[model samples]
Structure formats: structure tokens, C-alpha cells
Target: MNRPHYILQPVSPLFITLSLTGAFMLNLLPWGRWIGAPDFVALVLVFWGIHQPRKVGIGIAFFMGLMMDVHDSTLLGENALAYTMLSYLAIMIHRRVLWFPVMTQAVHVFPLLVFTQAIQVLVRFIVSGRFPGWLHFIESFVAIALWPAITWLLLAPQRRAVDRDHTRPI
Candidate 1:
């Protein structure tokens, strides 16, 4: 059986870095006691990790997490540890996850996101001996809900522009 061909576009490292920076900035925004504000930085990290695993891997995630740690003024290594784990998981499942439609991908991603959040919370509890408000856990679901949109936005630049001239092979 024959398979359809697809045109793949190259992604820039600078673009990926900029995207991660934007997400970090979004996280720093004051959402004012919102329970499900969504962890923008983590979401972006996971996206890049899954789509561009070669370029965006555990080291990048760890650094991003450190920046988040400092930005949030929380424990030093908490976010770093969580992001490291998230990136590892993202890379491991990247191929399988990317093969699915966006909605289906989100369903696959929710558990991973939740796992990262659970790690973060576990670290926080270990450091401070207390759990955050129950609603804090809802943020992972919020991120899950926004996955399709986020994937579209981040992948938009990397999508190949189709050529109408059918004579040439892609």
C-alpha cells in the first residue's frame, strides 16, 4: 500500500527559545488567585520536548525549570526536578503522541502533565511539609484543555507551506 507524503519544515532553535521565554513570561503574569491558570512554561517545555526532542531535551527543561524556580521564588530545585521528569517522559512518548490527532494527543498528554504536577507538588510538600490548595491540582486539567490550541500555535511556524503546483514532488 502507498502512503501519502508530507513536507517537513525545519525549526529554528532561536524560535524554540523565544517560545519558551514567552511561556515563562506568561507564567509570571499575575492571574490573581486563579486555581487553573495553567503552567505555561511547563506546557511549552513539554511541547518542544515532544516535537523537537533532539533540540529540546532534559537539559533545556532543567534550565527552564531553574528559571521558573527563581522567578516564582520557591524552592531552588523543585521546578527543575519536575521539568526534568516531564522532558524525559515527553521524549520517550514523543513519537507515539505526535502520530495522533490533536484532541487524541491531549488525552494522551494529560496523564504526563499530571505526573509532572504531582512531582512538583510532592517536592513542595517535602520542602514545606504541606500541600497546596486542592484547586491547584486543577491546573493540569486546564493545561490539558488548552493543549490543542497550544500545539497549533507553536507548530504554526514550523508547518510547511503547500505548493499548488502538483507536478513537483514534495
Candidate 2:
């Protein structure tokens, strides 16, 4: 139950499109410390990077992050910077990392999230002259723990694509 596997397939562009939209919705949802955590954008990005590397990449991540930054009004390029780093990691590791069990890659990806956020924090600190609350880092923990399940949900399209033998070369 702790481990995850990437069974590659072609997923509907519709699902991918919806997933991207859903991520933004989730990102915008208001939440307290006791409820859900940060946006699942990176989680979706990671799954696509592993399962559909050709479809989702740094450009998408950067754009999504940029949108998020604009939506949240945090600083220009803050989320974009973090998202770009996450995208870079996913693309770079997609080939070999895809072979690893889902949980294994999640473990590795946890730091990429943290590191990216760390950069975001550093940049924020430089501009704002203060740090975000400790709970802000909590998103990393939530992301790693939630990776497998989120990955599973996005896998639907992959399976649908594969079922129809529409897998494109990654």
C-alpha cells in the first residue's frame, strides 16, 4: 500500500486539461492548518512527468506556477521559479526515475519541493524581510505523503489511453 508504480498509458487530453484546472481550484481553496494543504500542482506535474513526460514539462509547470503567483499575488516569478525547478527535476529524472517505485521517487521529490520552496522563501525573505509561517513548510510534508494517491487519480487517463492503444512515444 505504501509503494506506487507507473503504468504508462495515453490519457485523454481532457483529463489532463481538467486536472490542470482542478489543481488551480484546489490551489485557491481556502484552508486552515487542520484541513488540506497546498496546491497539488506539483504532484500532478510529477505524475505526468513520470507517466507522460512528453506531455507535461517545465514549460507547463512554469506557466502554471506563474498563473498561481498571479492568482495569489505573491511576487512575480516566485511560484514560477519554484515550479520551474520542480519541472526541471521531473524531466531530468523522468527517464530513470520512472523506473523507481512511486514511493521511492516521492521520497526524492520531497526535497525538490522543499528546495524549490526554500528558494521561494529565500526570495520572499529578501523582498519582504521576513519568513513565512512554519506551516508554510508543511506543504512539502503534505505533498510527499499525498503523492501516491494524487498520482493514482491522474493515472486514469494513462490507462484510458493505453486501453485504446494510443500511447505516444515518450
Candidate 3:
């Protein structure tokens, strides 16, 4: 099967901010406490890191992570550390990740999401000496499942129209 390649337009900083904010808002919902609840912030951070590394780098991830730490009331800097590392790794692999289709990209992303959660769990275990159990890792799987849809949604604003009008001259 052949896929039409789209020449994406330049991404707006405002859109990036909005998407990150929206993901943060999604995390604030009541269902966040449930097991296997996907980390929206992590997902979006990775997305932007992979697609626009210069625009969304370690600093942004760290800030978002700090926000999550405050919200969760967990050990300070826990999320920040995880997000920072995640962003770094994403940025390092961004070029290679972009060559794949969205579905394949999800395959590449699964490890990153799992690593993020593992860092959180490791921090919690070190601080409290309690394990959250294997179920905690399910969130990564859920986030991976959402990867393709999120890719489409986030890229929609940057995608140029497929049809060209003859009245317009290049």
C-alpha cells in the first residue's frame, strides 16, 4: 500500500502550547487515579519532541513534569526527572522515528512511555518502599494505542490541503 506523503507546514508555537495545555488538562480529570490511565502529558511531550525537537525540548518536558509532580503531590522532581530524560531520548531519536508511519512510530514510542512510567515507579519505590504492582505498566500500552490518533489530531493543523486550486499560481 502506498501512502501519500504530505509536506507539513511550519508548526506554530501557539498550537504546541495549546496541545500541551490540553494534555495537562486531560490529566487533571478525575479518572486520572485509575489504573492504566494514560499519561497525556507524557504522550504529548514525546509527540512534540519527536516532531519538533527544537521547539519542545528537555526544558519544556521538565516544566511539564514538575507540574505533574505538584499535581500528584508525589516527591518533588520525580516527574520532572522522568520527563527530562524522556524528552532527551525522544529528541535523540527524532530523526529516525520520523521515517516510519504513525503505527510504526508507536512501536518506537512504547519503550519511551514505559521508561517514563518506570522512572516514576522507581522513584516512588525508593521513597516509600512500596510497589504499585505490574498493572501500573498498562498505562504505557494505552498511550501507545492512542499514538496514531494523537499523531493525526496533532498534525491536522500543520497538514496542507491535498487538492490544489488551478486559479492559484505557485
Candidate 4:
């Protein structure tokens, strides 16, 4: 006799959209003069890109970057470029990342988050000749620290009773 295979329910598009929207709303909130506020939008994009690559690909990341650019009043393509590249990288490593438990995954994800933030900083420096300073990179650390919490929050709702294979027939 074969053991039962448990499967999670398919995630709805509504949930994904709401998660991204919530990230955007968080990004919109002013966090005062602190220079290390995490990039919430990028965090959400990375999360979805890693977990749901088929649903959130480079195009969506680029579009979200554009939205962020508009929101932050930055150069039009700056974030688009960074986000597209980040999504590409996330897709490349999604398989490996997914195999790890969430805590271990954060260790793997930390570098990717730093790389994306580095790209953003580089682009801004190139465009304006202004260095965003060391504090800017600190946000990546904050993002890394928040990874487990964010993953828990986003995945909590979807982590329902795992269903047995019903399609296997009566």
C-alpha cells in the first residue's frame, strides 16, 4: 500500500494581489528620517517570485518596480531594472530556496536581498552622483531579519489542512 501524499490548496490570485497591495501600502507609510527602513515592496516581490514564480514573474516585478519608482518619485527605470534582475535571480534559485525550512531559507535569501539593494543604490548613484551611504545597505539586514516573520504572516492563511490525493479515485 502506498502512503498518502498530502497537498496544499491552490492559492487564489486574490490572495497574491492582496499581499502585494499590502506591501505597497506599507511602503507608502512614512518611516521618518531613519535611513534603514526595509523596502516592503521588494520584500513582497521576492517572496512571491520565490514561492510563485509562475504567477509572479519578471514582468510583474518590473511593473511593480515602475510603480515604486512613481511612488518614490525616482528615475523611471531605476527600480524596474533592479527588480527585473532581482526577480530573475529569485527564479533561478527558487528551487533551492524552497527546499529549505523557512529559517534556513532566510540565510540563503539574505544575499539576494543585499544584491538587489546594492543594484538600487548603484543605479541611484549613477543617476544623481549621490551616494546613499552605508545606512542604505542596513535595510537589507533589516529585511533579512524580517524574512521569517513575513513568510509566516503571508503563508499562515494558506497553510490549511493538507488534503490527501482525492484524484487517486475511490
Q: Pick the lDDT winner.
A: 3
TM-score of 3: 0.95
lDDT of 2 at 42: 70
State which candidate has the highest TM-score: 3
Model 4, range 1-170, lDDT digits (tens) per residue? 26333354677789999998999888888882378899888888889889899999999999999998898899998889888988899899999998777788888888888888889889888888999788888888888889999998887766565654667542
Question: Clash number for every model?
Answer: 0, 2, 0, 0
Q: What do the candidate models score in CA lDDT, each in turn? A: 0.87, 0.76, 0.95, 0.85
13 in model 4: Cα distance from truth in Å? 0.6
Tell me the RMSD of model 1 versus the true structure.
2.7
Q: How far is candidate 3 from the true structure (C-alpha RMSD, Å)?
A: 2.2
Q: Mark the regions of model 1 whose C-alpha exceeds 4 Å error after superposition.
A: 1-6, 162-170
TM-score of candidate 2 against the unseen true structure: 0.82
Predicted structure 4: clash tally: 0
- Name model 4 segments beyond 4 Å from true: 1-6, 162-170
Q: In model 2, how large is the Cα lDDT of residue 92? A: 82
Listed in order, each prediction's TM-score against the native is 0.90, 0.82, 0.95, 0.88
| Candidate 3 weakest ten by summed lDDT | 161-170
Which should have the higher TM-score, number 2 or number 4?
Answer: 4
Residue-by-residue lDDT tens digits, candidate 3, 36-65: 899999999999999999999999999999
Error of 4 at 16 (Å): 0.4
Worst 10 residues of 2 by lDDT: 161-170
Query: Can you rank all candidates by lDDT, best first?
Result: 3, 1, 4, 2
